[model samples]
Target: MRSTMTNLWHPVIGIQISDLGEKRFMFKFFHRMGLERVIKGSPWTFNNHLLMLYLLNEGEDPLRVPLILVVFLVQIHGVPQGFFTEALAHQLGGFLETFFGV
Candidate 1:
């Protein structure tokens, strides 16, 4: 005895599941956290603070110039270790370098 069967099926509709990936999800998270504004404001504030310190220490505290510069550098370079990721920190540093010629 022998039995044979043949069947074929296909779905007429489809579904899509969004992955969103890491970067998009991070962007959405930052947007939700309201950190985008801080990210935008950070470099400006950092630079202005440095400029003020430079002006205040011009003659009286000339020795503090290097210290102030070092602090600025630490803040710029340490963004990753603080709150920002490596990529964001690098981008922020680049923006500051471009704007401040530092």
Candidate 2:
């Protein structure tokens, strides 16, 4: 059961699910700051074309894909600092400790 749940939520295995969680967090944070509607209503439409272009242009460097996606996310969406902040590690640790008592 534990393994099943972990596999279901794991970032490496479930990219869109993981990204959705991150996106929700970002959306809420920005909404609180009065930017969510603006971002969502923006003209930018995210698609796989850029990823395909990157793959074709850069060949197969594993790190390139994620880096490009991160850049695209930041440029297209006005995500909050907390979303990519260094403090995330500490907060994540505290969250795990509180939830799992680990």
Candidate 3:
């Protein structure tokens, strides 16, 4: 049977799934597979609620968000490729280590 989901592609990366290091690609994949819309909000709100709380606590300027998040935005908007040549490395290392006994 043919796959119903649209294939996720990125210009520089070619096929996105081939670069699992790009977390943003996973979002696009989920979108094409119809899983993104099954939930309430789009990917931007995926972690906003929690991050908002962190921002409220830290009193950090929203303009000064950590680099990891900015990387995601940069990747999405196709900003200066010279700036962010790649996505941040695997963020779940410690979590996976803790949960899955890696």
TM-score of 2: 0.20
lDDT of 2 at 18: 22
The whole-model lDDT of each prediction reads: 0.34, 0.34, 0.31
Worst 10-residue lDDT window for candidate 3 reads 1-10
In angstroms, how far off is 72's CA in candidate 3?
10
Stretches of model 1 off by over 4 angstroms after superposition: 1-70, 73-83
State the TM-score for model 1. 0.23
What order do you get sorting by TM-score, best first?
Answer: 1, 2, 3
Q: How many pairs of residues in model 2 come into backbone collision?
A: 0
lDDT of 1: 0.34
- Rank by lDDT (best first): 1, 2, 3
Q: Give per-model TM-scores.
A: 0.23, 0.20, 0.16
Pick out the ten consecutive residues of candidate 2 with the lowest summed lDDT. 22-31
Clashes of each: 0, 0, 0
Candidate 2 segments whose C-alpha is farther than 4 A from its true place:
1-82
Q: Write the number of the candidate with greater TM-score, choosing between 1 and 3.
A: 1
